[model samples]
Target: MSSLRAFVFRMRGGLWTLLFCIILALARVTRLSFLLGLPFVILGQIWRFWAAGSIGRYRGERVGAEHLVTWGPYALMRNPLYFGNGLIGLGWALMSGPWAICIFVAAFALLYLFVIIPHEESFLHETFGTEYQDYRSRTGSFFPKTLPERGRLTGPFSFSVLRKSERHTLWTTLGGTFLIGLKGFFL
Candidate 1:
């Protein structure tokens, strides 16, 4: 990977957090838009929560999975975290305005497509070799493949894992929504 790409892979989480803050701070929520986007946000959170519970806590500032999680949300997509992020971002954008939607799509494509996903894919390939390749082949990055995935699933979900790693996301989701709603209705 290029130095720039490596740097981005390292900073991807912070970047997304920054983006989420920007989105929340600038969001122009309306009842209609908020209602429309609520489902997406809920679904995204559910997805993220499930993924966090399925996979173990993120170990360090590196792209290494302690175990290849191939059950639960992993069965549906290769990058459930990113997929959920996309959904959340899209929902936020939708709540914000049309311009935010455009910005979110562009940023998502640039960050996830060009930098983060590729780097993570490389690392996963290096780490798991054929196992990851097979998993990659079977699963879509954001969704499941057309064909049914038939196999004995591994790895059970754990709420403890979710609590350890994902409370911030939950809190942010709740706080952001509250602020947006408050701003829309009262502020």
Candidate 2:
């Protein structure tokens, strides 16, 4: 892993984590627009679970990948985890029901656009070179659409990976949810 890129990712990861926690706490406190936001949160969690499973199943690393994962969710979205995370953030903001949260969302998007994404892309370009370029050319970075057309990937979506990765992601999501719920009650 490139030290610079890794550092940037870790820093941004911390920021996002903090933002998520704060939003959860506020949501729990204010009750906010829990009705409208809950759906996005649920959808975010579901997407996160799916993306995490895909990553764990294929051994994807946050730093960058060892082998190019061109099957499963990766085939559909070049950056499934980021997309899921974005959804989660957007959902949480909606739940928070504040202009500040919208600003936070916009800032987060900017961070990803200017800092995190570019760093990751440079690393990928350096690491995977042409192959990554080809994949990027064909795949959507944040929105999943169609799988790569070269060859069809087959295999039943395994519950095993889901079971394993969910331990981490699910608990985190549950914590966030509880915090939001508590905020709602207090509000």
Candidate 3:
């Protein structure tokens, strides 16, 4: 059997699990709330774009930050992108109003807490060492500990980052919601 880390990584760092569950649960059941969740799908895409822009040009797959992003939404929460993704899942559950979807969201959150976050932290610690430790000490993992302050270092903000990140996430976010709507409309 594959090891736990292997399995989690295969889940694309737990994103696959949440996306699958969101699609499965919402598509399986039809409801008005699912329609309500449509907006959050768009918001999720926006969050993904902004977070990627903040991080740099590459996707979130790189854990070892060549540089720390202490600006943008990152200034508010260390993991705003992940938190926003969770909100997307939460909105999906709200849209579907399905008990099963709710369970899936809870499961996703737990898996992230237990499986994904720790692995990512270990990687970050190894990568950034003391800098990462200090960031973690001050930053909240999933919530904002304090108000955001403007960044000291300014780099050229790249829309390409948005395009790049959104390219991967948009399909899952919008397409998954579309699939749910399709099921709701057709079946």
Candidate 4:
């Protein structure tokens, strides 16, 4: 189970990207579906940018932050980045239309629930100790239940952090949306 969790956690992003590309290639998108999915994709990007910018100060040359992040979108959700990823994926699935959206979302949810969240929680607990535990006690993993009750607000939003954390995400989202739009246009 641990091995599976590790594998899924490590590969989740790449695997999802590949899946989205394959789905896009196979899908017969319509103008209506593309338009409908556009809003989700946009919202996902906004969420990612907000989370990234909020955590920029703690992101100095490390994957694990020196302190817990609980501001901006983090104030809303424990896993805003994962939530953003879900929205991006759901947007792509919606663009695919029909049963594909259901399958993608189901797979995504299972992956997050069974694999990603557990692995991340273990790491956070180890790194941040009581701070993470208290935060976890108050915060829902994927959904925003309430504003964070603890943790110091980080410094102001940082474009550098946004650029570093989200450059690939932003580019791929735009590219995928463009391809879907092109497919719809041509069809």
Best by the TM-score measure: 1
Better of 3 and 4 by lDDT: 4
Give the per-residue lDDT digits (tens) of candidate 4, residues 1-187: 8777778777877878777877786677887888788899999999888888887663322236667877777777788887888888888888887676867777887888877788778878889999998887877888866765455334458898788768888999999888888877875
For candidate 1, lDDT tens digit of each residue in 1-187?
5677789988887888777777767778899988887788889999898888888665345777876788877888888888888888888888887777877889899999898888888888888999999989888988788444565244677778788778888888877677667777777
Instruction: Choose 2 or 4, whichever is better by TM-score.
Output: 4
Compared with the true structure, all predictions reach lDDT values of 0.80, 0.69, 0.68, 0.78
Which candidate achieves the best lDDT against the true structure? 1
Clashes of 1: 0
Better of 1 and 3 by TM-score: 1
- In model 1, which regions exceed 4 Å deviation? 147-154
Candidate 2 Cα deviation (angstroms), residue 151 = 6.6
Q: Is candidate 1 or candidate 2 better by TM-score?
A: 1
Q: Give the TM-score of candidate 3.
A: 0.81
Identify the superior model by lDDT, candidate 1 or candidate 3. Answer: 1
RMSD of every prediction: 2.0, 3.4, 3.2, 2.8
Task: Estimate, for each residue in 1-187, the C-alpha lDDT of model 2 and write its tens digit.
Answer: 3575567677875677777866655553344466667777688788766666655463333665666666666787777777777776777677676763766577777777667788778878899989999888877887655656664343235578788756766677667766666766764
Superposed by TM-score, candidate 3 places the C-alpha of residue 18 at a distance from the truth, in angstroms, of 7.2
TM-scores, each model vs. reference: 0.89, 0.78, 0.81, 0.87
List the lowest-lDDT window of 10 residues for candidate 3: 147-156
- Stretches off by above 4 angstroms in model 4 are 57-63, 148-155
Residue 111 CA displacement from its true place in model 1, Å: 1.0
